[model samples]
Target: MEKETDSSEMFIDPVCLMKVDSGNKNLMFTHQTRTYYFCAESCRKRFAGNPDKYLSNKSPKRKGLWGRYLDRLNKTTGGKSLNCH
Candidate 1:
């Protein structure tokens, strides 16, 4: 049988906020009477270990363009800041 790829059937992974297929029963966990789907086993394990961390009331902070650039720079330069003249 062929599986349908419907957006309505997609569930967000609580840990990473990635879209997960609801039909993928293997990468899912239940908590507080709600079933959470995951895109990977690592995300599922993280959520299962600390459900409250991902389910917290606080939303993720949005980083601006400069902030994103700095993050990428830091990652690529091994924490060494480079000044362009």
Candidate 2:
């Protein structure tokens, strides 16, 4: 287990960050003591099915303008916004 402060610094799935229950352990992970939030049980399942795949995809190389935009939206929405855009 990781400290809450350390977990707070981890990356969160853009889709999950908007949900009140997004940080559930069943739908999250801790890598290097950093917590990661997932969008849903399915997303968590997918990640668990192949952690390497998702973990590898987590690198900066996989991020794009859309991701940044979504992150900005997440912050502005107060984590309550929802859009498949």
RMSD of each: 6.5, 10.2
What's the distance in Å from true for residue 35, model 2? 3.1
Which parts of model 1 are misplaced by more than 4 Å?
1-8, 57-85
Taken over the whole model, the C-alpha lDDT of each candidate is 0.85, 0.63
lDDT of 1 at 49: 97
Tens-place lDDT digits, model 2, residues 1-85? 7655443444456433334343366777665675567767776666666666655654777676589898898899988868769
How well does each candidate superpose onto the true structure, as a TM-score? 0.59, 0.41
Clashing pairs in 1: none
- Tens-place lDDT per residue, model 1, 6-76, is 63688889888878889888998999999999999999999999999888723457564568899999999
Candidate 1: worst 10 consecutive residues by lDDT?
Answer: 57-66
